[model samples]
Target: MFKNEELEINLGPQHPSTHGVLRVKLRLDGETIVKCTPIVGYLHRGVEKICENKTFFQGQVWTDRMDYVAAVSNNLGWAESVEKLFGIHVPRRAHYVRTMMTELNRISSHLLWLGTHALDIGAMTVFLYAFREREQILDCFESFCGARLTTTAFRIGGLREDIPPGFIKQVQAFQDRFLDCIDEYETLLTENRIWKRRTIGIAPINADECIAFGVTGPVLRAAGVKYDVRKAFPYAAYAEMNFEIPTRTEADTYARYLVRLEEFRQSHHIIQQCIDGLPEGNVMAKIPKVLKSEVNEIYHPIEAPKGELGYYLVGEKGGQNPYRFHVRGPSFVNLQALPQMTEGRLLADVIAAIGTLDVVLGEVDR
Candidate 1:
């Protein structure tokens, strides 16, 4: 008689596929994952604690580092939170510009995800093709804010400055050509035999389970939940924007891929609307040099590219800094579902599972 034995292994704190300093302790039985535990905090910078020491205005820069891929979205969330806490209303032009920037950020973030996730699943060609379009978006970012990645693009009351001359034309150029690029990516993977074989039924979960686990973003939406922070709790001109919340009932890796892909198109639509209906007004509201808050506490949540990125601020009567500052990073919450998805699956499927979650370890660990 032959005996089956269980083996324990560590996936990474150094493995590239783990998507940053994330280590997974896996109990395996003949290549099947029997149990999984995710180990994090290798990249922790005490971001929340650090915010408490910095003034409210200064803390805006730190939000960029949390989800470094979509820094504009982080800027929007934090700026809006500060504005809310101070009871300052942003001007109409600032609202439209912020919305446009955030939607562009969403497309960029999703492009990165699609490229890397496809690469993880063994589609190298898609990776190269995706970055080509991504570069155009980055070019727009650089021209607008002079910074590409960690752009501190938003001010508390509004934007730092108005869009430069020809900025609208550049965005329009990208908009006109972007859909064909999405179609190219889809042709590569959407119906490819290998992609479907690898992802179609992998890591499937129901809507209830996702909600129970506090998962958000494409992961939750793929489970057939129509919950989108932009739609449900509109902010930064989202209430005025017309877009669809893409969802799928399959709740598998393939479904997540589709949901994110659809999001790219929707983001493009919102950006077009912003460009067409952009209001003419002051970009920056008149705000005091020294910002103080009297609100006891406030929590503002926004639909970031990854998920619901929220800032919880505890304000002091006269202090320039928040007494208590915390962030609800979607990557961190969505990552908790990894073990549930990976357990009982083959070791190779772990890569696909993590890729589909679209988690950034910078956000996860912070």
Candidate 2:
């Protein structure tokens, strides 16, 4: 008699497919995973611990680095939290601009995912194509705040800078050309046989399991629950803007792909609305030279690329320094389901599953 023996295998802390310093210890029977454990913390930069030492205003910059893929949205979350703690309201124009940049960041994130995800699935052209588009968005970030990644352009009271005079035209140009680019991406992989074979029905889970696991973003939406923070609980003028929540019921790798594809379109619409209806006002609310003195703060919010971001701040009375600060990141919570989600799947499917989760290690390990 012949029997299959169990084997324990290591996926990576250095593997490119694991998406940034994630190491998986897998117990397997033949090629099938029996039990899986994800080991992280390789990238823990002590962001929270570092925040405690910095002033509230200074701490907000650290949030930008927590998720390099969508730093503007990360910045928005921290700024909103600090504003909430201080009880200060941003101007209408600042609200509109924040919405604009955040939506752009969302599209950029999805593009990065699409490219890298496609590359993992064996579509070579997509990696270059996706990064090509990403470079343009990063250029916009540089033009606005001088940093392509980890942009700390949002302030506690409002935006760090206003849109330059010709910036609107540049943004509009990107929008105009975006449809063709999207169509090209879809053409390459959306209905491709290999892509579908690698993704469909792989490591399936339902909405119940996803909710129980506390999964959010495309993972939850792919399970058929349309619980987007933007739609369910609107912030950053999202309530005023027009957009739709993209959902699917497959709860498989393919469903997650479709959900993200639909999301890209919805985000595009939101950006156009923000640009069209942008209000006029001071880019930033005037603050005292001493950040530790003068005003406290107010409410602020912007829809991040991942999901709803909740921020709360406690600041010193009559000082600009924040006494307390907290940020709720969607990626960290979303990643909690990895072991549960990856168990019972093949090793090849493990990579497929993680790609569908779309986790950035910086956010996951933050």
Candidate 3:
């Protein structure tokens, strides 16, 4: 249906709005976009190759660097993959700790997304306020893992250790204060006529188009596809917890925005369950002191802050390291639909559409 004559223009590699090093070549007809082809690889860090060179647990640090915004999820994913490969079962407390950390990271990620996405569409102040909340989340991560951004807290079988005394109390306190900040954020935009006008019905992508284009996570769910790896494929103890996988049929910027907002609430709910259901078990499972990579194959998939993050590992029996390792970065897949989603939408809506998609450079380019 996008039949406008092509007029190409470069859209980002350095632009702050893209939230990454993606260079999208936009084909526009006047002020309306006809097509968009996203060019990538600027931030390529060879994380997959790096994973192959390291031992199972050693490779986890690389995961932390991939999706920097949600290091906990990335760490959890790689660890889970190695665990699957070696048949290393995790403990109950370890599962709870992983869930708590990952959910906190999820909130941190969405906070950054909301801020940056809003800023891309002209709401500058939202960025600052969102970070204000993000700092608290980061504090929680730092308290537990010691590093706020690049945390290698999760190990092959489980966590490096147990959560420190008072950590749960601090997370609970942060959660208590966090709801008010969410309210503040919603009050700023949810009902604002300008926000709604700029977002609603702009850049609509239908459910089939989303699936066809390989969209996942909130973007796919925003199109009313309730396919979360967490619920459908229960890795960790997510099946034990209760939360909704927010979906919206509008499939536009506004719909995606609402979907993310609802997801934040759901993540909060999951965190509460994790805290309430904290069980007693060893944080780190007993395994071989060091892995002698016999991993012919390893597949670890987790509900990442962005979407589904799957780590693929391959190794020969008795090998010192993996033969190959690859990350199915959700940002890479989710972004494939950008061209289809932006078709016939205004030039301004392209940024809003991308913002709603919630991509990170480390994940997208890695």
Candidate 4:
């Protein structure tokens, strides 16, 4: 009688390809992943618990840290959630600015994903090329806010201030030139034999499975779902902006790559519209000197760069701080599908699967 034995191996918590302290325990049958278990929490900072201790205004800072790469989007989501709870109406001009910033942050976040994902798949040139464009976006961000990475640029009612004199021109210049940058990246990877072979058919999950797993953002869209929070539930001038939600039926790693690439174009379009039709008015709205909410509890979700980033706020009437605060981070939810995607695939394909998900550990563990 012959017997087969499965081999168990740990893939991270320190491995570079696992991307930031993510440990995956893999049961391998000779390089074929028979079973996979993702272990997170290495980056946990108790962001939700910390928010309960801080005033609503101060809690905005921690949101930036959750998805540190896409800080502007985090700021917008946090501010809008508080605004909804307080019934504070942001000025029209402020909404436009917020939309523009959020879109720019989206592009920046995607650029980082592209670079790092390509690097993981052995396309070194694409990494440098992607970062070249990302740097310009970060420069624009630093010009608007003092910080490039963790820019807590939004306030509970509106923005911290108006756009600087040359900020619009700077953004416009980048917007005009950015499409060519995307083309350059595609030239390097979209049709490359190795790139296609590595990504095209790896880790496919159907739209039904994605929904069942509570997935959102590009992963869900790549699986042929047309759900986008911005279009379905608009906020922060997204209703006024015209853009298409890119979707693919392939439901594979390559499809996700294509969807995100098209998203770059759509984000550019939204920003251009904001610039062309930007209304002139107060950037800040009138609110009480001290922040307090009559609403006992409320939940608000925004189309963050990663996915639907929702916040649940609980507090009593006239409370200075939230009694309880919880954040539904997209990365945290999205990470759940990792094991499903990686199981039964070749061990080498694990890196490709993880890269395609575009997860940030900070958001996952927070």
Q: Pick the candidate with the highest lDDT.
A: 1
Ten-residue region with minimum lDDT total, candidate 3: 292-301
Q: How well does candidate 3 score on lDDT at residue 199? A: 94
What are the models' TM-scores?
0.99, 0.93, 0.96, 0.98
Colliding residue pairs in candidate 2 = 83-298, 86-297, 87-297, 87-298, 88-297, 88-298, 291-320, 292-319, 292-320, 293-320
Off by over 4 Å in 2: 1-3, 289-303, 312-324
Candidate order by TM-score, decreasing, is: 1, 4, 3, 2
How accurate locally, in lDDT, is each candidate? 0.93, 0.80, 0.85, 0.91
> Per-residue CA lDDT of candidate 4, range 1-366, in tens?
856889999999888887788998999998899999998999999999998888888999999999999999888988998888888999999999999999999999999899999899899999898888889989998989889999999898888789988999999999989989889988999999999999999988888889988999999999999999999989999999999999999999999999999999999999999999999989999988888767578888888878889999887778888888988889888888988898988998899988988889999998
How many clashes in each candidate? 0, 10, 0, 0
- Note each model's CA RMSD in angstroms: 1.0, 2.5, 2.7, 1.3
Best by TM-score: 1
What is the C-alpha lDDT profile of model 2 across 248-282, one tens digit per residue? Answer: 89889889888888887887898899889988878
User: Residue pairs in steric clash, candidate 1?
Assistant: none
TM-score preference between candidates 3 and 4, better one: 4
Q: lDDT value for candidate 3?
A: 0.85
Which residue ranges in model 4 land beyond 4 Å of their true spot?
A: 1-3
